[model samples]
Target: MCLNSLLFFRCLDALVHFKHLTSLIADHNPITENCFLPPLPKLDLLWLNHCKISSLFPWVSKLKESCPNLQHLCLMGNPAAPSYFNGGTFYEYLQYRLFVISQFPSLNHLDDRKVTEDQRAEAQRLYKRPFFERIIKPGSGSFSQLVHSSVTWSGFQNKLTTLLGKDKPNDRNLMI
Candidate 1:
């Protein structure tokens, strides 16, 4: 924190020790939305994967002006929220100025790495198309990766049309 010596305190019952804070990793939890790591001047590594977060990646970017020694930051596996996914279903590189990278200039490692094939497939099967599309068309690519050529895609769509039951998504009703 900007404060020189506030001793230590807790926020919303989240344990935070400011004096020796260095590495913090709290992934796959809902509490991160309310937790704040006040510009930990000594922090070096931060991991925030799958907090169900809708906003901010490597959020420590906000601490660029203060944490000059930080070396690693990770913010991966955020959901389909607009702020998390941008325009693509997959995570891509950030286009904006990396404030933290600029600050720590030495900060060369970001651990928000990519996913595996099985991971991607599992994700697609869970989120994108309804269950029927998957069962009827089975994705053209490996079950884990969903990439269909035009021909296969059309076939998959047709299969979906034929199999869509009374509970199909509203968009399916207007498909040409």
Candidate 2:
């Protein structure tokens, strides 16, 4: 069913009772992560391309639990376009960095193209380190603790540069 262009209506709580919904095209709506509070067990195709979605990490991460049968997803025009995360196009960034295939193992078609087994395997291998560092082996300190740690300003900048692969100017020194 298509529910596109509904400006004010963001929540889908009322649709939770539709247990057998197989396809949902809710594009051009103001939907966010809160819209899918309850799972849509039978949903197979979901088109949520152009909306106010800002971060795919948290939103799409819950797709497996929210829509177990989802095979096709179109998140093309969202603010969290994969290109913004890296210097490549959305598809390339999605394939290498975010590991979209790994995140949604059940997804067969993303933005209309079929996902190949080889591509899935490559994504898993390429993003293994990032996945482990971000999710599995997060830094030991709590948020505040890490923020207030005694590490020098330059040290922090160096670490950030290393992680993000950005260059730091050699002429300037940051003091805390």
Candidate 3:
């Protein structure tokens, strides 16, 4: 079926036992504001780059659970997915792994590997909005609490950059 803003995700979710869904470009659409992964049970090669999503990489784990042979995940041009890492902590590294291992355990390359200042600002802009603060899962506390609990945007800019400036590439093959 032909996909557009209203029916794309609905169609994708209804497709049972999907094997692969590559390069899903859903830009310039209103649905990108929320999570809209296609839920491919056996998917591989996702390309959600530049979508204005606000999930803390939930699809990562979902894809991992479905696609055993998955590789290459992309989430660029969003505020949440940092473009360049100023620094990361042991906790950040562990959280990244935990989020991945649980779902994208077999993923090879996660695209959009850069966290620039503007992206952080962009992410901040999204966070600062009134809708996001009141719309996400409750008990997440206020915006500060959620940001701190999320990925890098959580909190650590102070020590993160100085702490992980020399750290090596984190390559852990997790199995969750």
Most lDDT-accurate candidate? 2
Q: Global lDDT for candidate 2?
A: 0.64
Candidate 3, residues 20-121, lDDT tens digits: the string is 554444443333434434456455566665555545645544445555655666655544454445244445444443344334435566553433344344
lDDT string, candidate 2, 1-176, tens digits: 45543345587777778888899887888887656646888898988877777665566657667787778978766665455533446454554333566667778888757888887786565554542243212666555665576767787666666554456454322110
Q: Which segments of model 2 are wrong by more than 4 Å?
A: 1-8, 83-92, 95-98, 127-176
User: Could you tell me the TM-score of candidate 1?
Assistant: 0.41
RMSD of 1: 15.0
Candidate 1 residue pairs that clash? 121-144
- TM-scores for all predictions: 0.41, 0.62, 0.40
What are the RMSDs of all candidates, in order?
15.0, 7.5, 14.1
- For candidate 2, the clash count comes to 0
Displacement of the residue 75 alpha carbon in candidate 1, Å: 0.4
Two-way lDDT contest, 2 vs 3, winner: 2
Q: How far does residue 89 in candidate 2 sit from its true spot (Å)? A: 3.6
- How would you encode candidate 1's per-residue C-alpha lDDT over 19-89 as one tens digit per residue? 46788776665534435555567877766666655544444344453456667766565542223454532
